[model samples]
Target: MCVVLAALLAFELFQPAHAQIPNAAQGYQRELTRVVQQEWGMNGRVAVHAAQIHQESAWRSNVNSPVGAQGLSQFMPSTSAWIAEIYPDLGRAAPYSPGWAMRAQARYNKWHWQQLASAADECQRWAFALSAYNGGLGWVNRDRRLATAAGDNPRVWFGSVEKYTHRAGWALRENRHYVRHILLTLTPRYERAGWQGGAPCNA
Candidate 1:
């Protein structure tokens, strides 16, 4: 009995803390699925998007960050306005609306994905896109250019362009952590929880 109890304790201790789906995220699965499919088609990386949302707002529809980011997708006011303007179908900037936030997040991620054609692979492309989402596409572009100038592979993200940022140390750390946390950590977590899309990094 002692040995059996010890084995059970070990199993529980070894389990990932985030292995379970977040309670806040449970309510939005259907809406997220619909939005992701609409924006990215059937094979869209829903898990990746879900993980992004997890990082952004932990599925809190009413969250407002100290820096003025808002809602589930955590879009800053300026970004929300811009996205609404560019995609008029999204209507007014309603960052606090769960539906709007999910759709806007998908659209914004798609926009980043479209511009990163030089990425070495799907995984690298997503890393660039996520970095763009966290910081700015201009930063990623400059970093890639700098990496190229230094003989690093501009198409790669992890050890290449990610190492060439011109942003301050804090911003650089946040961006890199944001990309890796979403793609490498949270993506797999969402995928394992039975989310429809698979992890891009695992591809």
Candidate 2:
């Protein structure tokens, strides 16, 4: 019992200070916390979602991408419409509603992850998943095949698939940056939350 208590105390001592959710993002952070922790059981990786919120629109509910992605998670109008058709409550929520947009993001990520089930671990899994979230899954998969044909592990992301994406013409930098940024944002927060080995190269 004494050893257990000490272990727990050590864990608490090393945890990072709470994430500094921005003032304008008060409600957005709250809803994101709820979705990542409660609905998705991703409490250890809330920062990945937080990273997307930051990258996509800097937590702005009203922001719109030049490509037509709107809201905190930057869903395209057609994608938003499709999400709404599949999830009535989530889709019905205003595009500017942080909760709704993030909920959609979580929903999309859940489905997106299914397509990469062969990923070696959390690192590889999220790397490919985030890339797919930015670029199309079809393209990410095509690159994965290219990497494998060139003797890389299709299941490993960093040195394998991500390396090949640099030579990919369409959105090459964007796709690589998407995965890198998410890992950067995710690792710090998750480590603070007691998660282990979430780096881009971990798997």
Q: Point to the candidate with the largest TM-score.
A: 1
lDDT per residue (tens digit) for residues 36-86 in model 2: 665567543566777677778877889888888889889887778887998
Local accuracy of candidate 1 as per-residue lDDT tens digits, 113-135: 99999899888999999999999
State in Å the error of residue 171, model 1: 0.2
User: Which stretches in model 1 have alpha-carbon errors above 4 Å?
Assistant: 1-20
Instruction: For candidate 1, give the lDDT.
Output: 0.87
RMSD of 2: 7.3
Q: How high a TM-score does candidate 2 get?
A: 0.78
Cα lDDT for residue 35, candidate 2: 82
TM-score of 1: 0.91
